[model samples]
Target: DLDDPARVLRSNPETYFKSPEEMYRLFPGREEAVERTLEIAEKCALILQDTGVHLPGFPIPELYRNADEYLERLVMEGLRERIPGAGEDVFTRAHYELDVIKRMKFSGYFLVVWDIVHAAKERGIPVGPGRGSAAGSLVCYALGITSINPMENGLLFERLLNPERVSMPDIDVDFCDERRQEVIEYVIDKYGKDNVCQIITFGRMAARAVVRDVGRVLKIPYGDVDKLAKMIPGPGVTLSKALSTVPELKERYEQDPNVRKLIDLSLSLEGLARHASTHAAGIVITPTRLLDHVPLYRTNKGEVTTQYEMKILEEIGILKIDILGLKTLSHVDKTLRLVAEHEGIDIAMEEIPLDDPKTFELLQKGQTIAVFQLESAGMRDLLKKIAPTTFGDVTAVNALYRPGPLGSDMVSDFIERKHGRKRISYEHPKLEPILRETYGVILYQEQVMQIANDLAGFTLGQADILRRAMGKKKAAVMEKQRERFIEGAVGNGIPKKKARTIFDLMAFFSGYGFNKSHSAAYAMVSMQTAYLKAHHPQAFMAAALTSDMSDTNRLVVLIDECRSLGIVLHAPDINSGGVEFGLSNGEITYGLAAIKNVGVQAVRSIVERREEGGPFKSLFDLCDRIDLRLVNRRVIENLIQSGALDSLPGNRAQKMATLERILTEAQKRQGARDRGQTFLDLLGSAGVSGEIPLEDVPEWDESLRLHKEKESLGFY
Candidate 1:
């Protein structure tokens, strides 16, 4: 109120530039054309002076040329402000690139990436060290935003961002696989719910799913259907190629008339959307409310879902931030808890060793079962072969073993580095430190940016433009850049032919380059989980299995791991087993919630009654205490079959046989309790008199008892 607030924006009347159209609109008069052109050229001069480059080509890049001259001038001035030592021409490309960024007002876009990621680190969340071309950013590296320093690594910023091609900077953050979601929730909270959402992705009907579904719908015999399906490789095999790959399926297709029809239908539907799922981590947060920009819906589970998939959302100008859940963070958290309680060191997880010899030994030996993402059999083989000796090796394996990198010539280069079969080379003297770790191969997007800047007369800012174009793979933009790069190299006195060859190499690596920042982040998690599996095997496995109690194979593998570690496990005892798999006195108490045919309501009734009274004294006592309506004889028989009722002295079969007598006694006892006839009911059996009297059946043999327990308990 004290100030003329409106004048702050309106009082810029001291001869600033405006376009002819803009001037006509702002102060429309035919007489003002000469004055407006004068103002515009002066503004353009000021912009060019900031870049210190004589504007030679009529068009440099889109950001370089004519605009509302004042807008162009303001953007150029903003570029000067961003990069302090702006050169006349070389840094002019950078200044021009900065102008593109300024025109787009993407300073805040980069800032948002830093803010959310640093917030996660402040909360002790393990974000990746650096990933992709975002690592090529000196601003990012300086801010600890990206771990790989572009200067040291020779990563090119142009490979990350090119004014030649205007696009959003994509920085993917990696947290421990286990803890990725906590950061996602924080984003939803920071940006309002309406402005933040995870993207949706469709699952295409692949080979195995197609066969199983089609077989079911056709009502084909399951044995024949499954046999045909099994003959086709279930994982990664496509329906188009399955018949070609499997002889048995081919035989069925050629010989069986009905089978051919089923196959035909399955192939038609094979690549259709079988289901919808959230993108693993692609979340777009917007400055304005997102729903105003894109529609929203609730998934079946009631989570807020985005209408746009990853590519479509970006096309509409929404930013996608990947909030990946790293299971390693959860593992590390669980390990730390176990250590604090049991080991008494109270070791904070972050304080644990990154260079522990034992941990590396465990990884080198391929003993990384239940160790984050590296638990896969293939990665385990790589770990053993590489025999990683340091954190660098861990990160290298994380980056290099991925599908793209593994498929390329780089895998051989990486293998040579491990074995010293090929000597590491930086090509030019300056690239030594940049490529030293991965044996002179630029393994990341940052390395691409640094290369353009250091060797090819590109400023860090211009190099970012190059990075963007390469990542986008805009053919025309890359072609122009390729010429520009060769010109710069030849002008710098390098041979054009060699520059072309190097350019070719850069293009190849750019295609499959991973982000070092993200790889480091995930590698840290992989290390943490490996550390836990190495140290506190029992507690870690207990928590891991508890998270996946519904999965039978997971339960069995975890149990086996527990046994290998010398941790004892009790059978699923009805009296002691609670709803969750938990550690009790260094032994795992099996979760009764995992038993077949025994529903949660029944488990809840049994558990609540046991907690209220002492433990169940016998079958009769258990049936008497809980509601039998929920806990039917089938449920009771399941409990007995699972050895959950073994807390009582009699064999499982005996316990099962007595279920009839027990239910009869239980109904009478319930009546006595309901009618307040407890004292007389026990002494004279009056309450029990009216109940349908049932007798106990004969007990089963021990082998049969154990076998029955295995069936219900999933002990196999």
Candidate 2:
């Protein structure tokens, strides 16, 4: 009965549900099985042990006694290199951070992160300047784990690690996407493979997805189901909440019996595990075999992963780091390599002047097609409207161009004050310096903390607490902090009215304020990409095209951008271009591998043949010079249609017309050559000089030519 499809389809939460007692009646033997299971469960006892942190220790040299000592030595060395002749205040800040880190038992964590970044640098992999709140740590800066100087950037250390609220420091590292796996492999080698595994995540059915899924299982029409699903608003809206909030949906549920049935079934299935997969960036490394602590499961792809998800693993004292793969890093690295290869100049990302006028000019004009972060449509509009001339403005733009800021007058006010259309003023004189960079707009959460510290006389840590309390909107906590802030302000000679006003403003803006550390770090990346585009347009665009080679829509946009930049892109040339799009003679060349149906191996064979011998004189020359096994008729047809063979001979129509005969002749000539027969011996002539001419044919019409080009190359 359970195996019957009709009964399965008939089952629903409203009318056809089974009780536990009915299950015993449905299958009489089940009661004995249940009793036996409960007896075994009663015999078994489980205890939840408080396992301490299981982070793998960083190996230090004999000269250093512990990870803390080694971290100090490395910080001292990096301090000299990063900031020469550091002042007493810098030393004092560094020592304070180091002391806090040592006391918190996170020296090993910092050293481990430093080692990963160091390995990335040594191997020439592109890592982001910084990510998340970790950028606020001077210790991170000195160790070269992060590039931003917290003191200069006004980033607060408390935001990263509040000494009062102790938790594990999480530092998510981003690497060039193309080479991110290499770093993960390195970690696996250092820590035994048994101790390292990726974390698993479950994908739950949400409101819209559950609607469609239940509809499909019930054999409802896709269009009707899709319309019903679209009525549920966006992600994270539960079906129950949607039915209550959406008037149309509730009316339909009351009026349409089928709609109510579908939705009711969907609600039962909602939030259940739809599938399980590996986490994209989370990988755990333990001090011993991972299975000894956490149970492991093998994914369908044959990857061993933890049964517990990231949060569960964290709760059980396992260390998980997000080794995020960012494609923008790959684009930057490739652009730098292209710059060096094409024009004999060495360009380092760190050495690129952040204050380059040309870079800002390009950004201000909104020419950020391939620029990181600023390439979005809204960001581009923001850039053009703001016309940012400083790197600080770029960072502020990054922080402000979000849903919270855009939905309110925050972005408009920021723009107006930036252009002086609106006056920039603070409630109190002490708020000016803290909000000056943002034109008196509280654009960053760090600014909120700073304002609290400067005006209310709270320590940075206590200020962090106020920021959190305001962000979480806990009435009790907010009242207590308000009292503390007003009392502290009165003690510091500030009027209570002014202090209350500032606190209210902070509370209102705290919800919209962004992380300055993350904004500055990503803005630095955006600047690096913009700098390359300004100085090395051809190389940068070529690299951008190569990175997005597989994405047709992006390729079309990039090609248009190349045209706007006044860079002429020649058609793919069999003799010149390799598998990737590249720069040649101050112009971009189309990559042969970008064409549809043309494999990389086929491109490699064509390039190898052209490099070994001279350039192919004609279409026949191309077929005769290369093996037809890899570059078969389909490959040849694609190349001609894609314009890769345009330089070799007759027009696309003519080459395609005579392709079959040319391939036959080339195969015969190969057979003759294998028998040690020269052209003279095989054909009784000294050499075969020219291509065989088929009946005279006109070139493809302009419209047809462009259509074919778009078909094969993804763009005309």
Candidate 3:
């Protein structure tokens, strides 16, 4: 009977909890096993209550006796490096998670996260310091998994993981978006490529999409289908909700057989998986070749993917790593390279000082553009009034500049407090240090954790547990924690009612506390770019424009940034423009590669040929010296239309007329040279053909020329 019950628990592996009676029936009178089953169920219940409010998490499997003691041993065992003091002895919420992890046998998961993130750092890929509840972990900061000291930030580890609330840590790492692929490749190389693969996501038939698909398949009138699809409410509500609002649809379902079929089928099919695509940032690594544990499929690009979803992989103990590309890192790298070439400066972009007053002054002016994650117009407006003066301000503003805070009077309060116009009140004197930097407000998860430990005589690990109860919004657990906290505070000579009030306040905001580690990590990038914009506007803007060359709208915004900085941006110039934007004589040089129809390789070829045999004197000289096979007549026409060939043109129409003749002659000359013919000697003996007017085509008007240029080069 006990065996049957145990089998049932195993069958329901997806759910996190089981009943004591169920466990007893499965153990068949084995007292020790039966006892363990109750222990497991109790642990699962404590964590599941956490999920109902906010944390939807699965419990870690049990390994040894005594959760905290087991965690200590796991900590000792899972040190990836054997250096002295590479131990998890720190106080904070992170510590609590580590302790719980050891007892729960989830130390391997932390080690796996550490290893991948370490590799990223080694490669100088900017991994995010921490995100979500992970920032509350002191262990993460100690492990260098995060850079912001949670001890200083006052983060609660229990918010990340708790003895009572056992769940896998949802840790996301950020790398420079451009360099993110390099880290993924490294993982593939370390773990067997077959054993590592990104997670697969399914695209569902959303309300409008389902209706459209049904309409197409049913051969309904196209206009009718489009109108009906548009009539479906969007932004949040789905087709099912749309049908209720549009009584006409209801009437059609009742009155028309085909419309009824359409509506009914669409309702059933909405949200069903329509196609499978690999997760953009999620990847899982297995101990052995992935195929040994899970079935795999190949993407269109021939990349392997596990048949198991992200959760399924975790259930089986496969490690999941999110290798997110930050795109901003790519911009940084490109900017550095441009600076090296154009300014002859070996400016170590990563080594830029974090505390630059001038940079903050510019930020205070609300002059941010082409800055990672901080260029929104609304954000600019916030910065103008806030007048942030320190690295802390950047972090605070970044965290507070989101939706809820924007809607509330939070922005004005934060600004006034930071500038000293408003008094910073901690509500209690002992909590002053923790609240001082953030203007007497608990804006980070770490702060809540630190406050719990400081005032309540709780250990850092226990504080983390309290943090979780608060963050989860579990009313029962929160109520219990509140009573215990008040009792502790009263024991420590604080009023019981005041303690209760503060605990309630922590509960209100802990759910909203931004991770200081993540905010600081991102703020570092935003500031570095800001610094560059402050001092090296031309080079920074050139790189920003180059990175966004393919996107006219973004390029347009960056062009505006360049103008505000008083840096001139020249249009594409065949003679002076390099492959991408670069600074020259205090101005942003146009990128020939950005010119539409001009591929990088083709432009590169032209540049290499020019470098090898000196610059061209004219159209004839260009045709004679360069291989025009790659930059054929059409490419030439585009170049002229974009005014890239303005150095040789009467106007676009004249150059367009003569482009075919130039390419044909270049091809003939190349063919002769391949056939062992001496074109230079023949031309010299016959005397160079000159003085003849070569197709004096009419010149295009300025607007016509610009339009053609825009069409060819993808400019607007």
Top candidate (TM-score): 2
Ranking by TM-score: 2, 3, 1
Write model 3 residue lDDT over 469-505, tens digit each, in one string: 7778888988888887888887888887778778877
TM-score of each: 0.66, 0.91, 0.77
The prediction achieving the highest lDDT against the true structure is 2
Which 10 consecutive positions of candidate 2 have the poorest summed lDDT? 682-691
**Of the pair 1 and 2, which is ahead by lDDT?**
2
- Cα lDDT tens digits, model 1, 186-252, are 8777777777778888898888778878888778888878877787775788866878877778888
For residues 1-716, what per-residue lDDT tens digits would candidate 2 score against the true structure? Answer: 53234674645664765666776787787788755756897889878788667788678899989998999988888888899988988889888899889888888888878888889889988988889998899999998888878888787788778887777788888899999999999889888899888999999999999888877877889999999889988877899999999999999999998888888888888999999999999999888899778999998899999999888887777888899999999998888888999999999888888899999999999999999989988889999999998888999999988889999999999899989999999898888898898999999999988887888788888888888899899999999999999998888889999888888999999999998989998888999999999999999999999899888899899999999999988888887888988988999988888888888899899999988998988888889889888888999888888888877657999988898888888888877888998667656232356356654689999999999888888777
Worst 10 residues of 1 by lDDT: 50-59
TM-score winner, 1 or 2: 2
> Which of candidates 2 and 3 reaches a greater lDDT?
2
Write the candidate numbers in order of decreasing lDDT: 2, 3, 1
